[model samples]
Target: MSTLAGEFKSAYSAGSGDALAAVFTPIGTQNKPYRLQSFYDFTNAASLQKDLSFALFHGKSLKVPRAEQTAWVDIFAAYWEAVGELLKYEQDWPGASLVAIFTAWKKVANALIRGYSSSAGIPAWTLPCLYTVGKYLRTFAINADIKAAPQGASSFGFQDDVAADIEKNAHLEEAARIINRMFTLCLSDRAPMEESRKWGIYQTTNLIFKTYFRINSVGLTKNLLRAINAQSADLPPLEAFPKSHIVTFEYYVGVIHFLDENYAEVREDAFFRVIGLTQLMQAEKHLATAWSMCHRGASKNRELILTYLIPCHLVTTHTLPSDQLLAPFPRLEKLFRPLSNCIRKGDLVGFDKAMSAGEEEFVKRRIYLPLERGRDIALRNLFRKVFIVGGFEEAKEGQTSLRRTRVPVVEFAAALRIGTHATGRTRIDMDEVECLLSNLIYKGLMKGYIARERGIVVLSKNNSAFPGTGV
Candidate 1:
């Protein structure tokens, strides 16, 4: 007849105070005696351990239907309340309560996810819930570690908990997989690039990138990259995002490639793509800091790299909150950590480590992973012209007025600044641009366009006229 009897009739329930007190203390009683509601709260919280354990181990047999979503929400909410109680008393139980809290948090996460797709079919709110749980887990882990450090205590390994959960559970993987699959399906199938859905997709993808970057498992990184590529065709034009999601993806891909030691790929794909995201970078301070590093490269080759790369770094580090950003990227902090050492010793190795670390972290999180392949295609277009003279010029309509009938090849090094589309017949005498252009022409980056009847010359398209690749 009791409410607890009706609501928590499931075998998973752990019963009331005397029963639970044996396992953990009774902390949530608001009034005199233990009522049905109290029992409901107590039982649900304890049940979280069982729920998560079951989901992690036995998810294969589970089926989450639309009608059960609400039930799951109630189940999760009860657990959430219980966990709050546990945290308040974590000082008392230490390891035991910490483990219990972790287990219960997992259950709440499971319940929320199960409820994500309701009778309405995939509640629009599921993405938010997913991100919230991810953040909560992350925060809880940090807090727990911080609490344990002073006491000389360590257990319930929070990172291991998350890693294991993700590694073991089909549902968590499916949650990530399904969102990625949706993006891929929509993009490849030419499904409408609905703005409404992209926000959620972007956040989820962003989380996946952060997690994999933390683990530094090349296998995970490779898989995430493949997923991004899978949906590349369905992505909206890069022009669709000037500041937010688009720039974020580009920044991640670039840094990931940098870490992977694919320098040429970083240069062609990330460094050159900065023009599109420049507006976004200029407004963000952290971007400016990284941009300073971009300019710190050695030699003309490195200098050329810094042009676009600086922007990518800034976009990655500054655009998102520091907490939400890819701070956990493996070996990333280690790379930057040596900056002080470099400054202290004035050593090249330390300098290189710091520079590469900062730059690579930015590139992976912001440039490479989430970019559509169209971006790759764009990068390739510019890559073809990297060795060509005047190829970096921003040539518009192929001519610089009647006086300058053809886009002239300045020295290659000079062309790096002005781009492939110079407008006037200024009779520039830069030897670097001339040599670069001539070499490119020889190498096929610049095809000679001659009007035989008019005895005039024209510059062929340097792929997309330098707009797409930033050259």
Candidate 2:
């Protein structure tokens, strides 16, 4: 039985990504018969079509595995060898040729993907080619109607759109049809290749996304996302895939959620530093690398977001990554710095301004949703600072930090307006100040209860103001 990975042991051994110029390049020099070119190049359409058809027609089907994973590799190798001929298209092939290839490719590709599992290994070229195979159907079908001027018109660029919607849509339909089929094959709940399929599916899904992104179509990925999330409990952990795949998968998946403002799903819970990837973004990159990793995924190229968000004030105490890989998260740090500062000082107005200023930056990074949760950070910090302020100036062992904490709402309101000189209002809105304080205590930023009847704020003396934050 033939195995693509075994054939290119050197490349697979080299880990992910071809050290060669292009990703799709042949691993060891025994060149593949077909090479990829533009969609509009039809220098020898008739001959190319005829030759490819004959090649696929007479192509020998080698006896490979019928068992779980081996069956998939056998099927993929056979299917790719057939489509490999079609991949040599210059630009556009006859609409008939497109139809013929899609049918043949889909029939075989679908069958094998059904048996896909983590039990099998994927060939480097197999995945890249599989993606292109599907993508070309969409691209060439669109260009079929784009003909050159009879006498002579502008013989370049996207001249005109003459393809009928039916024809154009048929091509798109075929592309989606293939994607859906693969989705069912690889992502089934009891999928035979469930374990290995997890990562293989990422490569498959990445191509699907590339397909959708190409036409600038929106929302096509939502269903795909739903399907994965539906079986998320059974889905393998990040450690199951190659570190390289992890980065690419997380990059696409994380960005997908970020763009849609589906931040809560990414965090799913909470920990610290880079709230989005609580466990994923932390400092475990060193152990994960190209092909040599034990089970670790490399850092965000440097600094792994620490397990604990080392407070900006005590950054010195945290174990930092080397400078090369320890780059601070661009947008996360942008939001964290301001939110942390205002919370430390209990500056309500400053908090507002910081959020307003960083709003554009967050949106630009497509992380607005996750960063929006920074609101909780500010609330916690502001109240954290306020708790400190209400404490005695001089500390003594065995004494409660909140000994002088019985304060009136009116006084607390005055405290909020302390740094405001322009308005210089001696009185602040009682409702707003209490509302803010109420939220702080409710969220466990402080340990205390509100005395609505007396309008006095009683701070907790027995424990730290912040929950789980006591000494």
Candidate maximizing TM-score:
2
- TM-scores for all predictions: 0.38, 0.52
Q: After superposition, how far is residue 7 of candidate 2 from its true place, in Å?
A: 12
Q: How far in Å is the alpha carbon of 433 misplaced in model 1?
A: 28
Q: After superposing candidate 2 on the true structure, give the runs of residues whose Cα lies further than 4 Å from its correct spot.
A: 1-43, 53-128, 132-178, 188-199, 206-240, 246-336, 364-366, 369-376, 393-402, 419-426, 468-471
- RMSD per candidate (Å) reads 15.7, 10.7
Candidate 1 wrong stretches, greater than 4 Å: 1-75, 78-82, 85-91, 94-97, 117-122, 141-198, 234-244, 262-471
lDDT of model 1 at position 283: 29
The candidate that wins on lDDT is: 2
lDDT of each candidate versus the true structure:
0.40, 0.46
The digit string of per-residue lDDT tens for model 2 on 360-468 reads 6444333344444445555555455555566563557886443455667776565567744335566667888888887667545567778989998887665555665
